[model samples]
Target: CQELPLIPEQDSRDIEVVCNLYESLLTLQRQGINGIWARIIKNAFAPLFNKEFDYVAGNPPWVNWESLPENYRQDTKPLWQEHGLFPHGGMDTILGKGKKDISMLMTYVAMDKYLKKGGKLGFLITQSVFKTAGAGQGFRRFRLGSGEHIQVQHVDDMVELQPFEGASNRTSVV
Candidate 1:
């Protein structure tokens, strides 16, 4: 969305897409996402938005900014550049290029666009968000309108356990 707003305005199709996906895309057995949304949608969509909702939940794709292709980095720069979460600079180069995951960025986007004020947000993100620095600090840092900030409610530390089979990356619900 080229809309220069804090929250992207959504359309009816977005409602339909999200409703259908969430309603049926997952199973009790937990089938892994194969090839991801890019392969599933064939480039027909973008992130959905609305004025507000009581809550929003997602298990976003877990790919790091450094691992993304150059084109994607270029493509999303307009939206995420201000956060300084993308790969850049000398300090960032040493800190794994200050790599941030796409899901981390989506966390901000989702909270801004869909979540109502004082609403609770929950997502499954990399545990590195609590352990690492640089971009990780950006995730833990919360700022609202007019440079105001929010507070952390709780964090369930799951460092010593593996939540998903064959998934070596440390992750947790936040």
Candidate 2:
């Protein structure tokens, strides 16, 4: 498929559109031997099925904290706090510390839930996540709870390459 329809939550219209697109693609015999082996999960953070893999990779959404829906923010606030991604309080919150991209949380959750020991994960995330002082401090800490830590093996800065069309955000592969 040229593109996978991304509906963060269940929406009948979106699902129908995706199904129709798939059907059209399948009619053209585009699918391989495995056919269309895909699971459109309702939620990535709280997945219904669970499994650990040796490797995981993704380009999580780059929504800022203020852009998130109020309900969603409220619901996931506990998880963010538990993961130490949420800002402490007072000056931290006022200064927008740890309130930048949601991708950081997504990265944390993906590694915490899906990756096995000795596993490696690659994520294409905003470069500001590393350079900003207050924004990604928690993420830079590299702690994954229960005394577990992730060793960042590599980082490839792609800011100068301008790989994406019509996108100005600085990106990096980690």
Candidate 3:
């Protein structure tokens, strides 16, 4: 199971999905939340807790090493280390050096579980993949190493205009 701690960016969506989906928060408002609701809510979002798919999609978290919270950094250090994404977790932010981004990790790691031979994958990702060689090296490496098992189907360059309002960084569909 993916033990995703409620990081800063996902709190709103996580809370909404957890509480609103089953009206558990509504029940809490009238009767006060109880252990049963908590358990039910956790079970209610089982799909979020556990993931395995043939065609994984959607935007994963974009937090890079420098922007990540200290607690999250601590929690994912071992995983990053094992993947060779964040060696020592210190040199990641240096210029021209490969840095760790959650989205980069998800691109391939998801393949290990959700995608396998003959499976396809896609994501709406940041344009950092094109703008910076180092920022997107992990993702590049994943595709490169996948050999003939993975092939580039399409890449929608959304950089002509920003997709997210107020987001300076452009996005892409790949």
lDDT of 3 by residue, 67-167 (tens): 76566567656655555554322565555466556776666566655665777778887767555756665555444233434466788998776778887
| lDDT score, candidate 2, position 145 | 60
Worst 10 residues of 3 by lDDT: 141-150
lDDT (Cα, tens digit) per residue for candidate 2, span 85-136: 7645778878666566889888998889889999999999999888987888
The true-versus-predicted C-alpha distance at residue 18 of model 2, in Å, is 6.1
Superposed on all Cα atoms, the candidates' RMSDs to the truth, in angstroms, are 10.3, 9.9, 9.7
Query: What TM-score, over all chains together, does every model reach?
Result: 0.65, 0.73, 0.60
Candidate lDDT values, in order: 0.65, 0.76, 0.62
Candidate 3: global Cα-lDDT? Answer: 0.62
The better-scoring model by lDDT among 2 and 3 is: 2
Q: Which segments of candidate 2 are over 4 A away from where they belong?
A: 1-40, 43-49
Tens digit per residue, CA lDDT, model 1, 55-165: 777767788877876766776666575543443568675757476788877777777667887887888788876777666766666653334455567766655677777
Q: What is the lDDT of residue 29 in candidate 1?
A: 18
Cα error of candidate 1 at position 61, Å: 1.5
Judge candidate 3 at residue 83 and give its lDDT. Answer: 53
Which portions of model 1 miss their true places by more than 4 Å? 1-48, 84-88, 95-97, 144-148
Query: Against the true structure, whose lDDT is highest?
Result: 2
